[model samples]
Target: MPAPSFMGIYPPDSVQEVHQSLPLDPLGPGAADLLAGDVEYRLHYLLQEAKKFMVHGKRTTLMPEDIEHAMEALNIEPVIVPPRPLPQAPFLAVPIPSGTSGAQQQLYTVVDDEIDFATYLKEPLPPALANSAGVKWKAHWLAVEGVQPAIPENPAPSSRAGPSRLPAPTTGAASLRPSAKQHLTTELQLYFSRLTAALIPTLAQLPNLPGNSAPGAPQYSFPDAERHRLAALASVRSDAAVAGVLAYLVRWVAESINKTLMGATGTIGCLIDVVEAILDNDVLFVEPYLHQFLGPLLSILLTVPLGPHPTPSGMSPSPFELRTRAADVLAKLVNLYANGYPGLVPRLLSTLKKALTASPFPSPLGAEHPPAGRYEGAVLGIGACGVHAVREAVWGTNGDGLGAINDLIGLLYPGEGRKNKAPLVRATMKALLLLTVPKPEGVTAPAPDAAAVAEAFGPHFVRAFEKRPWQAQELMRLRNGGGAAEAEVDAAGEEDDEMEEVQA
Candidate 1:
């Protein structure tokens, strides 16, 4: 005879014993084997169903609740057992028979209860078993007269709906019709409503100042609130939904430009928060509509007066601060995505130059100068282009590049036709310093041409430094070519100290 195939790990003897435990007639041929196989199959099926439950709950480990939920979902009624009290002196220590191992003899015990076995058997069992919560099975119609009832037992509404109620479509074309964009728009609106409501408390902290608590007032806190907003936005699973929200934000900023500074700043801040969240998510695929974002982002960055005009007598961070913030976002986008969109950097540079050099309001004195806010935005945008792009812009890749270095130098030059706004001069100096500084180690870029930079701005460099006295010392050191090395050494020492502190 052939050896029995390993159908499963379930033992046939165990199956036979279970079968014999039940009060039944003689078993048919191969009944034990059939029973073992069925038990194995059912156990495997139960595990597979339990796994679906785990995944549905976004869990890694299987829990008892998962199994319960799985059974509930499958419409399987679970068998529960009532708690029973222990009988007094149920087992008694008894002497083992001779010739048994000492270990076996020590382990053996006998039941001492001597109630009538036949009398216990004659008693009827409870109709329904109780669970830990003392819940008992209650009978309800699984289906009544071919119609499923929507009871707690049958929770699915679609399952309860009868065929008679489900009307058949009269025309195939009508049934096959596509949903309108208005439906999508309505759904998006609802999603945004929920999202805004959920995020408002966390993201929109009102200022504590008196008289600032009016309805729909714009009050925002930095970094913390922004972080909360980004986290909330990133948690959204649908890419298209997130994209729709982002598109709406862009439109919000575009429409809010003429609004109050408080309003425009709040909305622009939200836009930047959303962009940061999208970029932070490595799995989020936004490449397809990335270009669509550029227009709105650039518009915010290049807007001449980013916020409402501040009172001449009042002191606050410049209106250009908003433009600067938006410019920073633009720079990050360029650095991360420049290679993918070849024209992006060039277009940005073109737009920035135009903004920087465009004649300012004609004065009664017949003088024209670019606004400091515009100049700052343009300079920061250039700096954001990374070292290589800046070098190429300065020293042409093919002996002919946009003379960005010259333009910047000309802006910085004292007594030049350009207006000498303190902020504009400071920004230009910072941009030049960024361009001339040595590329950090591990960064593969051609070193800035010290000779070319010196020759270009050496004559007027002192005037630029005197204008920004606070940063002059560092700026002069950098321009003289000794600062980068010193800076690197200082940075290395700081890092070493940090490492030592962490180790200690």
Candidate 2:
């Protein structure tokens, strides 16, 4: 059926129910319909106003406060409805007297459970525990003058940025900023800075040195900064207190060696001198960082440097000279530190041994003889360990019943001239020469029998050392020393046999 038009819609039955609830007499038939239309229009008007409140508050959902606000603005009394304790309290399906149709409707509402106020007041509140540890403060540098120092407090360069974020050298005002690495003291920083600066060769017009050392006796040159450099090295060798910057100094020298080894003249020797200086410092305990020195030292001694090889100039030493210097350094290092660092000698021996073998570093592609440069270094490295090592390792028999090194030493091809110069032969001769016994205080030992000399050191060794009488005497000394060691061994075996018999 067509119904009366209104601004908003509300159920006619609902309006009549409200009217009936009032103490006033029920509305007339047409009055209920009119009232409903009026009620719907008023509700919609208030809602339209409430919508403004909702829009002003920037909310999509409407609240009871919005309705009340609309009513207040309209000068209308708002309904007094008690709020439920819980927002989501469920409504009950209260039954009413059966209507004409005898049907009932269910209403839903927020419902709350009953609580005992007396028990609630007595209940303890949850312990007030913190969600995390208490807030605290600490001081550390974020970055000093746009550069970070490698201290424990600061993030590591690799982790914070990337592996490429190396600590760069700063100058002027930037350097003045407190950028000490790992919390180094002010004095160490100054000492280290001075030492490094003084030792570094000041590149100038270097008077060209001997183009190359004369074949047999190699010559060496020194840089203009040799005085300051030597002084720096001497100070480093003696300064017990400089241990704090040892790692940095070692790293600096290693990097310098790598940079200069191929072409740059004179710098390689200076860096090595620095290492010797550090080794000389007896008061300082350097055993811990000694391993870091091996790779660079060996590279200078052995490896055929990559890239274009250049002629020596200024104080730049020849390859032969470098190998000699490196061998001496290794020897000195072993003599000083090997006793304390038991494995130091063995580790060096292993690397040197590999270098000495027919096939060394460059694997499967073997050489009849290891490269001349590497072979010379390895021989010196072994001899540097002292007479005892040379005796057992070089002179002693191997799987082939002759020492691997002993047999090879005789095989080195003897050729002369620059490119054909046999440094390997010279090196082998030097190793044997090192074993020669020193002359007694006033008296001298008679020359060894030629037969015995050949017997002890092999015929090739005897021929090699025959250049000088003193050389031959040293050879005899070496033979005598070997004979004495052999006698001792025999005696030891006899003693063991006697002990076994006595026990029986």
Candidate 3:
């Protein structure tokens, strides 16, 4: 049967007429909704090239200029917007810029986007204002539907508009909005997922490491509480017995559970309670056993879905954090699979794209540069991996994984020039190489449903290569520099020196 159609869904005759006048690609608008958040930047860039095909008064491919204008209208600052206060609950319910009430009767409005800490403090307080917890409260009664009403005589505080007068509570999850709660929960879940995915393959190889059957080292079990203990003992003895495998597996299981329980409010709360329990446990040195899992956790996290909403603090996880963890995971993953498991490459590439583009992150002034704390390499690394991965994966898949790769390219290469460059540029480069290489036996093809990757990426093929041409060139230079010969010489010299020193 044909797909169900609603007459109301069709554009009116007038709209169709206008469309006929414009030089528009039939597919662009249908695919436009996928251009949410930062994806808009990439779309804007694509639009610039597309406009050349458009006729006057006719819709054409979206051009960079068109995208730039759209971005402006959407309040996406090309230069990173500085940190601003989040509109709190009660404050959000009222109109901003408590308008002028004196003689002029001309209505003025406040745009929260225009109000920052400095200007807000400088503005005179409107009449009948209330202040609490360092946040000022006021209301402007503007005309609605051509009707204006005077303030009621001596109205109760709740009757007044603007920041609610109720005392703000300090703790408990109740303080967060439903959206914020889910967003934070999802972010946390994503973090654990990436880590779990990264550790799996390497951990799988651990059980077979040479000298794994050392004294006092207990064998690993498929399903047993004592497995972690056995793994911990192996790590302490620095034995090859357990490898880092079991530790990673434990982490994978834990993160997988977290992912499954994410939306189960009761289950999620319980899982968090469990995490808290682990955090509070002083007797168990969880970090040692816990740390190995970070790889897979990072991998899964990078692949997990994220929300576009902001946290209450007006801050998201720092870009620094995003870049560093992403880079570390990419680097570790490639190293683990370089000659051993190239099939793991596509999976890693898939994870990289998800982490960088799925959720829009805060873009503050300093966000342009590397973030100041840990995980700084995350954005740059992820971007680097994405750019190259998309190009290579698309090619490797016989132009199949192109959808995912392309989507990722849109994410990593949002605009022109280095100043606006995504932070995890290096990681993107590494992932690209990995994605381009053919998968080894036993590894499957890139996920088939990743069509969005190619659609998002296909248009920017040339631009993606141009964005970082030098990096590709340098990689070739390193490969041809008798790479393995130099390494072997260095290894032999180091061994000789060690033996000479012992004889002396």
Q: For this target, which candidate reaches the highest TM-score against the unseen true structure?
A: 2
lDDT of 1 at 492: 64
Top candidate (lDDT): 2
TM-score of 1: 0.41
lDDT of each: 0.53, 0.62, 0.39
Q: Please, what are the lDDT tens digits per residue for candidate 3 over residues 169-246?
A: 111232233333344555434433332322221322333332333356556423232243334333333423223233
Q: What's the true lDDT of residue 405 in model 2?
A: 43
Ranking by lDDT: 2, 1, 3
Which tens-of-lDDT digit does each residue in 1-504 have in candidate 2?
A: 233455445878887787778766546567877777877777777899999999999999888778878977898755553453446545766556566786776665546678997777566432221111343234568888999877898867657642222222222222222334435777777777777877764444222323433445434554445556667777897877678877767767776676556644455556667788888887877777777778777887676641114333344466777778877888888877787888877777777777777553341224453346677777777778765555555554321212354455445542223222456556766765544443447765555466765565555444454554565665454355546434543566568679978998
The estimated TM-scores of all candidates read: 0.41, 0.50, 0.25
After the best TM-score superposition of candidate 3, give how far the Cα of residue 494 lies from its true spot, in angstroms. Answer: 20
Candidate 2 or 3, higher lDDT?
2
Count of clashing pairs, candidate 2 = 10
Cα lDDT tens digits, model 1, 1-504, are: 223434668888897787789866567788788777777776667778989989988999987666666666676775443334434544566656767455545344556567995786566544333323355445579898999887888768755444212121111122111232233476666665555543322213423212234456566534444445545666553355566655443333334332323332444454455565566556556576566667766666565545433322322234565566666777778867887889888887887767766655332223354344555667667766654444444324421232443454454333555434445545555554543434445754333344543453543344554544334443434445545634654576568679978998
The better-scoring model by lDDT among 1 and 2 is 2
After superposition, the stretches of candidate 1 with alpha carbons farther than 4 Å from their true spots are 1-181, 185-188, 196-266, 310-317, 363-370, 392-421, 436-504
